[model samples]
Target: MSPFLINLALNFLFGSKGKEVIDLAQRLILAAENAGGSGEEKFRAVMTALSQYAQEHGLLANFPQPLREAIFRLVIEALVFLLSKQGLINTHKRAYYEQPTFPWA
Candidate 1:
């Protein structure tokens, strides 16, 4: 994702009504970390946690399915970008996201 898109997603996530989304992302990251396998396994763990979270939390329930999915994707991508920048997690996609511009700054 580009910095612009990442910034947009971050704006939404860090906004007033962002707690739920942020919590979901944090939980997913934790799930990935605890997956205990290759990068692919960690990715699967995040997706599995996402499913469970959706069932439990009804995340973005009021939104249409497509919009909700798009939001989820954006949230995950932006978060992974940020965390990887901080040397938190390595999904092997960091090289692609390294840019001179820092969206979270």
Candidate 2:
């Protein structure tokens, strides 16, 4: 599930469609599984890894500042929703996802 979410995020975040995202997704899945502390901490670790990957790989280099930030936020929201669904987060946080308007609720 983490792999799927990472793949989705990679596609959305970078518009990349290839092996690189697969490799990155594997790493993310491992990181998410092995991440220590509570669920929130694990989530933060994943987010940190994602942000670092974006910066190091220049995923958002072509975008304007505001647009880049917005995209990043959406990516994070999607990630949270995905991870939560996988039981990596507390599901009680959200009732549903039918609207696709709010990431958590």
Candidate 3:
């Protein structure tokens, strides 16, 4: 749901790093969860991961540009793919797509 942060992280994942960004993000998210944090906490963890990676890659200079949104959106696609691998989101204990079934329909 918080594409903003994920997309930002995605921007840091270009070139050779692109192939491993999802795995890195998943690891950060899982680690955050294992520490008893919520999904929002996981999101923040991945954002921090991306920021740190970008810093290592010297990609931080490009982040302040206004023209980067399109690139960010592109990264969002990969982030979505990574998040999907987590299977069902556990919040509220009900399936996100679950709807009331009409037995007599």
Candidate 4:
């Protein structure tokens, strides 16, 4: 299973109030895959979805900074894992190292 799917499953199984977020991420992942973009583009799409979810749901504001950071980290890691599984990323590199360079960058 891709990391995104795994995280979604685990969140559904163990995370309290994570169903919506997981479902959103899953949908975004599927969309990115179907869009047939480059690996980097697909990864960016997933990250963008996650960022949008966090902002829309006020996850960043509702949770403490540490908790918010942790959650974001988990989601990014899951995305990288999923992308890598799809042969989009080189698994040898650290996922955290590949930061997106947007205006938010």
Candidate 5:
């Protein structure tokens, strides 16, 4: 998904309290970079944060089923794009597009 859609999903997830989530996401991205993980790893780390936020907020229950599914998909797509841009994923080939093998996933 495009970054615009990702931003929209994030906004919806955070509601009017999105600042914390955005700050946390930024910090996590920086931490991932500092840890020297590949872009893919960093992206996965961000995804972990998203998952954690969802669980913590019980976001799924707060939304209708269809909206929840859409947000989930957007989050996943945003992560893929983030990883690809960071060169963590093998964008030159189609290899890393497989299901996330990360421990958290």
Candidate 6:
């Protein structure tokens, strides 16, 4: 997971684009919190919100479908790590808390 995340960060978040992705992540955290649900639900909400925002803003637009999904998954993992670290949510031991079915493209 760490390697995949590091790779994603390097691939998608270089130069000025890094700041934009960070800002998007911060907004995503707030959105998930406001979603007001159990840990899994809030986490799923983050991915859903991310998908919608990405589609609207053409984020990762040029990437292939598989690569785009991988990037989105890493983004969700990063967000979940943040949420868990801040004590805002707790995930089950299962890998990625059984990743929600969101539109990744």
Clashing pairs in 3: none
Error of 4 at 54 (Å): 0.9
Name every residue pair that clashes in candidate 1.
none
Ranking by TM-score: 1, 6, 2, 4, 3, 5
RMSD of each: 7.6, 5.9, 10.5, 8.5, 9.2, 8.4
* Model 6 worst lDDT run, 10 consecutive residues: 92-101
Q: Write the per-residue lDDT of candidate 3 for residues 1-105, one digit (tens) a residue.
A: 465665666667574665466566566556556656665665556555555655666774666744444444345445554445444344443343243334477
Q: Each prediction's Cα lDDT score? A: 0.74, 0.67, 0.54, 0.67, 0.64, 0.71
- Considering summed lDDT, which 10 consecutive residues are worst modelled in model 2? 90-99
Candidate 4 ranges beyond 4 A from true positions: 1-18, 62-73, 79-105
Estimated TM-score for each candidate: 0.56, 0.49, 0.42, 0.46, 0.39, 0.51
**Model 4: colliding residue pairs:** none
Error of 2 at 87 (Å): 10
Top model number, lDDT: 1
Better of 1 and 6 by lDDT: 1
Candidate 5, 21: how far from true, in Å? 4.4
Instruction: For candidate 6, report its TM-score.
Output: 0.51
Q: Write the per-residue lDDT of candidate 4 for residues 1-105, one digit (tens) a residue.
A: 666876687677768657665587577767577667687787667667766777887767767867866776687776666566566666565444445535475
Better of 1 and 4 by lDDT: 1
Model 1, global lDDT: 0.74
> For model 2, how does the per-residue alpha-carbon lDDT over 15-100 read when each residue is reduced to its tens digit?
86646766655556667678987877766676667667788898988889678767766776775576566676555665553246
Superposed by TM-score, candidate 6 places the C-alpha of residue 97 at a distance from the truth, in angstroms, of 12
Q: Lowest-lDDT window of 10 residues in candidate 1?
A: 13-22
List, residue by residue over 1-105, the lDDT tens digit for candidate 6: 364674476467685576676677777878787889687787678778887888989888888978987888887776666556545565554345445547494
Which stretches of model 6 miss by more than 4 angstroms?
Answer: 1-13, 60-70, 82-105
